[model samples]
Target: MDPQTDSQAADGGRVLIDHAHEGHFGARLRAAREARGYTIEACGQALRLPVRLIRQLEAGEYGGIDYQVYLSGYLTKYGRHVGVDEEAIQAELARLAPRQRQPDLVVTGGVSHSRYLLERYVTAATYVVLTAIIVVPMVWLGVRGTLDRDMPRLAPLDASPVAQQDAPATSSTSAAAVASATQPQAATPAETRPEDQQPVLASMAMFPPLDHSAARTPLATSAAAPAAAATGQGGHELTLNLPSASWVEVTDATGQRLEYGILPAGTQKSYHSDSTLDVRIGNAGGAQATLDGQAVQLDGFRRANVARFRVDIRDGKAAPVSY
Candidate 1:
């Protein structure tokens, strides 16, 4: 019999062969090979097959060959040429192969092309579903881990030193001397003594009480009002009275700027608030103001809103301020 006539027909009881699909597969294989600019001989070299065998396979007339085995290798080789998934193409070929009582005598009417079409579709959908199932959870886990890692640490606030304004100053120097003392010296490390050593107090000095005749006034007593609650947030505003130009920045509770600008001399800048403020009176030549009417004693650090002694910023430097 002529090899062409022996092949299954597209219709009738010849066999359940899909001529159109077979042709499409052949066209794709041919296009894939040619797209790489490879001739049939070059393709055969890659597959370790003769050029005649490759040409017969592309013509869809390799009846003498094991169609399943031959197509599997052919699809794999062609796939590499075009970067398509070889397994997916092999699966398509397996689904298209005729199934029957005997491979040689496949009965056409008993097979359903529609069933194979559905099977191919289901296989593709399963791959898509499996990919989504695997990838989505990984993405969610990455985001959740980032959020867990980024949460801010607040433990330091509870451990900070407290600043109590009502506490008496440790030094008895005049307020003028205190104001002039711009920097507080850090206390020397405490000297360790023997267990039997007794502590000693330093010598004391006293000044006579000021004469009240010049400023004598009737002693009036009024009950003090209850203290205001702390806002638990600290920030400051500065108004600069400069002879020339001066710029200053006031930071908020978190040491971030709440306001910043420039002003001229004798400009009564009022920065009055019941909050912890970070003031930077920058580039001013010998300037001063009444911080709540008591001279602006540019001394010791102020703590942050959350802590007692952590100053966020100072006159010209940054320090932790605590309340």
Candidate 2:
């Protein structure tokens, strides 16, 4: 038998093998998609399907997918987009169908062995576009603000320090006479204390009672509002607190990536952002967030589930915003 004809089919219920076509039927569909000027990413975007799924359908690699019904839909969409008639592809998939029995209704599975689609979303091109849209205004404000703060102020030319330093070095005689006049006269013997009679105070008398309030630092940082609330005139303060392990990524409205790492238990970090704060958590149940000081509720979020939130920071700490 030809090697291609003897090729193996996926084990899962996801795909059916059509030994009759020799598994090379994908060649035509691949050519058609390319002819339409759609790359894998563009095709996935336009079809609202994942790239891995498309690749699998093309290569007949369905061992990773868990759902048969979804595969049917993929086949349907793939045929429609590439001008493959429904009848022909259906016959092929039908010949490749799982043996023994089939379900009346197929439900999409929650997980997949293939993680390509997950990684795809992580590096989506949309993120770059979104970052550009958010950063332009922040860059303008930051530059303008820096210039205003650093601009030099001019002083009168006549008041230059050079003029003061050049004042004819006063005659030495006059300077000595002025110094003598400003100095204290030597004390007479009667007016001076004896060498052994220096004034002294008991240890208790040395220091007055301490006033705790008076010694506080004038520039110390303090909470701006009640612990449960925070106010922002231009933006918001974002904080992420992890009571358990979680992977997180954060980007400020200015498109600056603040952090992206796996946070261990008991880890907490804070940031201030203008406009929006973009966050991604690999384990939503293990992560908690706050806007300003107001707590964000993540009660419904599940473990091992990824969640993305885009918070628009506005004036004041409004109700916890989520995407």
Candidate 3:
């Protein structure tokens, strides 16, 4: 052969060898992946690519994805994951120049596509339901708390009419007893005849009218009124004053609840108990108490801004006992 012919034959032989060496790059990758016991899905997951993308790549189809830098990177990663040499994959990618196809479109009647859509909608609806279940009760409880805090104060019950009518008569009789006891006795007579004293005693017993003005004297009445009012008719009076809003509970000795609930700022309440009063105060620092006109010191009994104590009434005197 001549020199030019020999050079042309050498070039043709080199081209053929290169084409043979780079033959079926995708097929080689698939064989390598399978030999390593990796499924297409596993290889896709390992390389962080979609299963469809992995399938298209192994089938030697370069559709759906951008073919420039992205395809090269994906192939390099997938080849490395499947134990294929990176440099060989890159060289094949450069030489093959795979043709690009149009991206696959979703068909309306496709089963897998419909299932995927349904799953996404179901997941979103589940999230919404869970959020409502968590948030709705919290909102309702908050509103209920606000309404309770702003509730109106209830009026105390009225006293019986019988007690009201008898109060004045009892006070007047007590005053007469006090007046008679305080008055001095007249000097006793030196001598008396039984016959003469009998007529005077008989006449006095028949008439039996005493002076009302003397018995109900202003001095005696004034002294008795305060003593009667301080210790109420059937019980001792207890007064509670709140400087700020606080919760209060009062129970009598009979286990009857007298007052129970929150008291607003500047609120004053009175309770009557014949034997004892059990009291609990929330926000102790803002509350003041009085029993039978005597101030009760609550600071000593406070714990965590709450105070609990019992009031005992004996012989018309009130004393507090801490609990």
Candidate 4:
């Protein structure tokens, strides 16, 4: 092929020609550098670029440069320094660089697929089944336990035939004693005999007649008594007053639990016991106590905000005993 000359504007607006046989940009750049009698090192020094970078640029090896913009800038500087046209350098760079193809976009509605919906339904069903497996037996056991706890137990019946046969005889003897007690003048002359009177007296002593009139007296007396007197069978009474939330437990000497659990603010409660009473107060600073209507100071007995003491009946009076 005949040597081709590519003419391009250079530095100082001068025109230059590449006399290389091959019309490639790298060969033309090398030819231009030779025409200007400039070595790669001298050209790099003049353009403030590395010698290796100038060689790569002249050889059209642009892979060492990261971005196209940087490569374009370096090429423009190097070409202008060596009397090569910037437009020609840019055109050569565009031809050598790989083209970037934009991906095609497919638009769709924002609805979920049937398979995804089915998967979600299956997951929900699995969760429900798992929950039922865990919760159903627990609920059944709780209900069964509640039924067992609430169900009343019946007392065993007396099935002995001798006891059943004797019940009527005992009732008849009681009726006879009641009749004799109601009418003392209904005795016959034979019953008035000393020997006969003794058996009747023994029977009356064995089966006492039920007096319905005297039964009302005890009920009337209990109703007339104070409410405290009814619950406090033991002569001693203990009163507790709470100004704030606290826990109190009271037990009598008989090991009977009189009061227990958390008491709300402004709560007043009383307990009665015949013997010594055990008392425990949680949050002692908030509680006030009285034994037999006498104030019992809880502050001295308090330790770690808890007060534990005992109320003892001494000399017919209630007094606090602390530990």
* Clash totals, every prediction: 21, 2, 0, 0
In model 1, the worst 10-residue window by lDDT is 155-164
Residue range with the least summed lDDT across 10 consecutive positions in model 3: 198-207
* lDDT for 140 (candidate 1): 97
* Candidate 4 minimal-lDDT segment of 10 residues: 197-206
Assess each prediction's global lDDT (C-alpha) against the native.
Answer: 0.45, 0.56, 0.62, 0.62
TM-score of each: 0.24, 0.26, 0.29, 0.33
What's the CA RMSD of model 3 in angstroms?
Answer: 23.5
Model 2 residue runs over 4 Å out of place are 1-235, 300-304, 318-320
TM-score for predicted model 3 compared with the true structure? 0.29
> Model 2, 50-156: lDDT tens per residue?
89888878876656667777667787788788777676677656655663255589788776646867777767867987998899889999998777555443211
Cα lDDT tens digits for candidate 4, 220-267: 333223223224566777888877545566777778866544444456
**Between the candidate structures 2 and 3, which one is better when assessed by TM-score?**
3
Instruction: Report the number of the highest-TM-score candidate.
Output: 4
- Candidate ordering by TM-score (highest first): 4, 3, 2, 1
Residue pairs clashing in model 2 are 16-96, 17-96
> Which sections of candidate 3 miss by over 4 Å?
1-233
Residues 1-323, model 3: lDDT tens digits: 42333543778833222333332677888999899999998777777789998887777776566655677788888888888986677665655443343579976865698899999999999999999999999999999877656544221111112123333454656766576557635212212211232111111011113353352243223322221122223457888887754556677778876765444445677777677888887767769998878999998777767778899776778899986
